[model samples]
Target: MPAFTDIMSDAFDYFRAYALRALCKARAMPRGRIKHLQLVVGRIYNLLKKEAAYAPNTQQLQDFRAAQQLEAALDRRRDDGSAPERGFAAARPGAEREAR
Candidate 1:
């Protein structure tokens, strides 16, 4: 059987990927959906933090910090109405004018 730390490390990696996908999805999501994703990211950040406390390794600490940053960025985007603009910025240069 794997060690407890190994199990935790695997779980951490899984949640980290999950959080990344959620963050990307949040960028294009509506405000209400972004709000829900923010809560989910917050939960994942808390989980990473707790794991860091138990493991105290460099990689774990870095992941915890990244999760913290991701949550903060999501909060900022949600509050500042930037999420909607992400889609606009990704459009072709003349797409906005053409749509108008």
Candidate 2:
């Protein structure tokens, strides 16, 4: 059988949801641990995108309301489901060196 390229199952949705929950709660974790959890959440995001399992309005990175208070503790708090702005300009190619 061909490997499943796309699927929208309750299990996958639950995993994605809980993973975001975990990420929201990971603010209190150690730096390394938080990074690891973020990595896992990122992978889930990529896989879900590959599956095209997301609906029109649902956010992939946070709970429905996205009112998690732990965000207040972050120096770079992000409320949207978009990628966490971990570092400015780091994602852009040669951005750091270009500034010099």
Candidate 3:
């Protein structure tokens, strides 16, 4: 069997490739859709943050950091006007009601 570190490295590499592909696809999507994708990534990052807090393992921490970076990138994209005009609130449910 492969060593643990080797397996982890391979998995991380695969994850990077998959994320890149998804990002490329997202670039072609409409601004509203990108906002939704950003929201989804943000949620994933938050979940990873919680998980890392509970487990406190190296791998978990690394994954949490990666998610955090991705979330930041998405936020930057949104802020730069590449995502939406109405801002993040537009992507959340009941945002219109909340805004009123």
For candidate 1, the C-alpha RMSD (Å) to the true structure equals 8.0
Which regions in candidate 1 have their CA more than 4 angstroms from the true location?
Answer: 1-31, 84-100
Q: Give the TM-score (vs. native) of candidate 3.
A: 0.39
Quote the lDDT for 21 in model 1. 63
Question: Can you write out model 1's per-residue Cα lDDT over 47-90, one digit (the tens) per residue?
Answer: 66467545656676576567668777877876797656443352
Q: Residue by residue across 34-63, what tens digits does model 3's lDDT show? A: 656755654554454455434445675577
Q: In candidate 2, residue 57 scores what lDDT? A: 34
Rate residue 47 of model 1 by lDDT.
69
Q: Rate the local accuracy (lDDT) of all candidates.
A: 0.64, 0.48, 0.58
Worst 10 residues of 1 by lDDT: 82-91
**Model 3, runs deviating above 4 Å:** 1-31, 49-54, 83-100
TM-score, every prediction: 0.41, 0.28, 0.39
Candidate 3: worst-modelled 10 consecutive residues by lDDT: 7-16
User: For residues 1-100, could you state the per-residue lDDT of candidate 2 as single tens digits?
Assistant: 5556454556466556655665665644545534564545545544554443545335633532232223332324334424543445465888788778
